[model samples]
Target chain A: MKIAIASGKGGTGKTTLSTNLASFLAEEHEVVLTDLDVEEPNSGLFIEADLVREKDKFKMVPEWSADECILCGNCQKVCNFHAVIQLGEMIMVFPELCHGCYACSELCPTSSLPMIPKKMGVLKHFRNGNLNFVESRLDIGEEQAVPLIKQTHKYIDQQFDDNFIRIFDSPPGTSCPVIEATKDADYIILVTEPTPFGLHDLKLAVETMKELKKEFGVVINRFGIGNDDVLAYCNEEQIKVLAKIPNSRRIAELYSQGRLIYKEIPEVRAELEKMKDLIMGKMKEVVK
Target chain B: MKIAFTTKGTNWSSAMDPRFGRTEYFLIYDDEKDELSHYDNRDSANDAHGAGPKTAQKLFEFSPNILITGNGPGGNAATVLEKTGVKIFIGAGEMTVKEAYEAFKGDTLKKL
Candidate 1:
């Protein structure tokens, strides 16, 4: 089963929860901790993974040969993205605006358009014991993370069958990149706190998952610190509270020192173990 | 020649509203004549994407030799305007239409 741990607000315990959950599950199952948060992935910090493979991700842009230029404005008309342009005697393509749809090339009368690859990012695969850590890093100054995330998912060697347990640590927010990461998730775990910002963004995250028609559960980290608004909302909405980790400075210290919470707090491991069973039960309920 | 400045709207109704998309009160100062004239653009509503070619087509109706805006002129829009021999000034933040005209006459219109 593919599980996604996501949060709409940053600084929520998504990475913390994902790291411990993947590590805890790895002992009994063939696990893949895929960090889909390409922009700022930190899952590897917790897992002792060695980089095994690296590959480049590319985006497509329009390429026109000067010799075949008819200067017809047809290419410019069909581009819904406003990416193509027809100069007096030339056709030019902007790398950023092109969505790689190739509509311009199809519409060009001279058939002068060809796709040129624009390198966007790199994908790195790491193996540590039983767990596989996959991360995609966007190139510096690159604006798009969608292609890289898609590339990372595509590059995974495993076929999409209900076999191994896969936990995806997704990027924050309900933006396009977040949507890209969580779209194919069979189950979504929204990690949130009891803070006001957490509750506010949690609603957005819940709404997004509802829109995507994904079965979701909430995990409240820092459970005792903030107000009860999140619990109140979850109760009103009938959203299940899967697990809760009380706010502790020791947990925060362990996290900053790159230690998994379950590894540090023996009691936390038991909670995560129970959390996994709860998740399994919830998944069965939804699928049935 | 007259040009119009209309901010993007919030909804379909506002976007389609003729009063919201085009301005008839635009004043263009002809450098040679040293006088402001009523400049209007009536086509901003017809185009979507709000960039490149669509924007150029809307601005072309005003017969503007120059365009000043925050977004850099380029892509399909810039190419079309340049084909008509119109200069594009990107990063024209907070500058009113009259100020842009003065900047154009003084040869200070920065190219995108």
Candidate 2:
């Protein structure tokens, strides 16, 4: 089953949930854990996976040629990214503002435009036991994470087989990067806390997911500490509460020490298993 | 010796004169004799897009001795304005039309 574990807010244990689920499922089944949070991927810190492959993600930037000399301003007009500016007899490309769409070069009237490949980010994959942990890192000062997420998903799609249970750990919020990561998942696990801020963002995420027509269930982390607003919202929206992990300093301590919750609280493995079963049951309903 | 400022958004226009990028204002100044002129941009609204080329063209029609803006003259805009041989100043800040004219007249304004 292709499952995506996402959260509306950061530090809600989305990575903890995703990594543990991957580790537990890998014991008896083929599982792949993808850290789609390209900004700061922490999945590799816990999972003792051996590095096997490293791939660089590239974005297109304009390469100017002074030999073919007409200082036409067509390239400047076509650039929506504001990366290109035409100077008298000279054209300059700003690598920072570029999204690598290549629209500038393609639309340049002077067939003289050259498209150059610039490194936007890097993707690294590691393997431990039966699980594959793939993580992406965007270059410093790069604005867009959508391309990195898209490229990582493409890598997963190429290697994914019918049998492996793929679990993607998506980035926080309902922005473009988040939308690109969760698209086409068989099931989505919306990991959220019970705080008012969490509940507010959860509604936004839930609305976005519903519009995407994807099946999803909510997992409330630190349930006892915050109010019952999340549960109330869930009940009102008829969204299923798959599991509730109570606020535990032990879990937080274990996580800070770079240990999975299932390792410290092995009994939580049973809970995850049960949650997996519930997700699978919903999957059956979905396939029907 | 009226100086025309480009009513566009950029460091180039601001570099030349204070009121270059400011909305609802224009800076017209004479540095040698310290004379000043002010015009509201009520007549100019479409200046942000296309990198101040058309707006610079419009300002040049006013026959200013010096042009101040936040962007430098490197593109076709520079080529078009080179014919007038007007002094170009890039990277002017938020000096009011009258304030910039006074600065130019006082010869205290430094080129950025």
Candidate 3:
């Protein structure tokens, strides 16, 4: 089953939960942890794995050629992105604005615009025992994270199957990147804290899931610091509180030192076990 | 000669809006007609993406020979303006439309 651990607010223990859960399950099952947060992938920091393979990722954008003797404005009209514009006998293309839809290129009578591949990021695969970790990092100054995230998803789909437990560490917020990461998820784990900011952003994420009509549950991290507002909200909304990882100084210290705590901390490992059981139950229901 | 200024209001004394893409008002001055008019840019102000190119397209339709603003247009918009033969003069920072127009005439403002 494919699972995605996501949070609307940053630094909400998504990396913490994902890394621990993946590692804990890898002890017995084949697990692949793919970080879809291309902008800044942090889950690999905690995974003690060896590099297995790496590859470059690319995105296609139109290149406008002023030659061929046609002054038609068709390129700009068909380009909904405004990436292509006709300017007094000259056709200009903005690579950053192009969505690679190929409307302008396919519809152009003169074939003045040709789509070309542009290097956007790199994808790396790592392995440790039964666990496989994949990370995609966007090149410096790259603005669009959705394309890289999509490419990473494609890689995961092509390499791993339903037999291998897949967990996607999604980027923060309910933006386009998050939507792409969790769109095909068999189930979603919405990670949040007990604070007001956490509750507010969690509501936004909940609304987004409702819009997408996906089955999702909540995981409360930093559980001891904030009030019970998050739990109350979840109860009122009929959402399950899957697991809770109490806020601990030791957990933070070990995480800061780039160490896995599930093996060292019994309570944290028990929470991961709880999450594993819940996901296993959901997977059975899905198969039924 | 026709000049366009990204401004906060409709008149010559209106304050210049630094950004070209999301500026509130675009004031066009036609030297031959000696007439000034305003074009509202708020239609695409909340646009999700490509606001720069959209604003540049609007400026292209106006057929201005010059554009003055606090900050110049971005890469995408710059391409459109450059292809359309619109000479962009930036550094109008915090100047009124009348002052900016004088600065343009005196060649004091920097060209983008």
lDDT of 3 by residue, A87-190 (tens): 66777777767777899999989887888999888999999999999999998867788888988989998999877889999999999999999999989999
In model 3, the Cα lDDT at residue B16 comes to: 97
Worst 10 residues of 3 chain A by lDDT: A279-288
Model 2 segments more than 4 A misplaced: A282-288, B1-112
Specify the highest-TM-score model's number. Answer: 3
The deviation in Å at residue B103 for candidate 2 is 8.3
Write down the C-alpha DockQ for each prediction.
0.24, 0.11, 0.67
On DockQ, the stronger of 1 and 3 is 3
Quote the positional error of residue A211 for candidate 1 in Å: 1.6
TM-score of each: 0.78, 0.76, 0.93
Cα lDDT, all candidates:
0.72, 0.74, 0.90
TM-score, A chain, model 3: 0.95
For model 1, the stretches where C-alpha displacement exceeds 4 angstroms are A157-161, A282-288, B1-95, B99-112
Q: Report the number of the highest-lDDT candidate.
A: 3
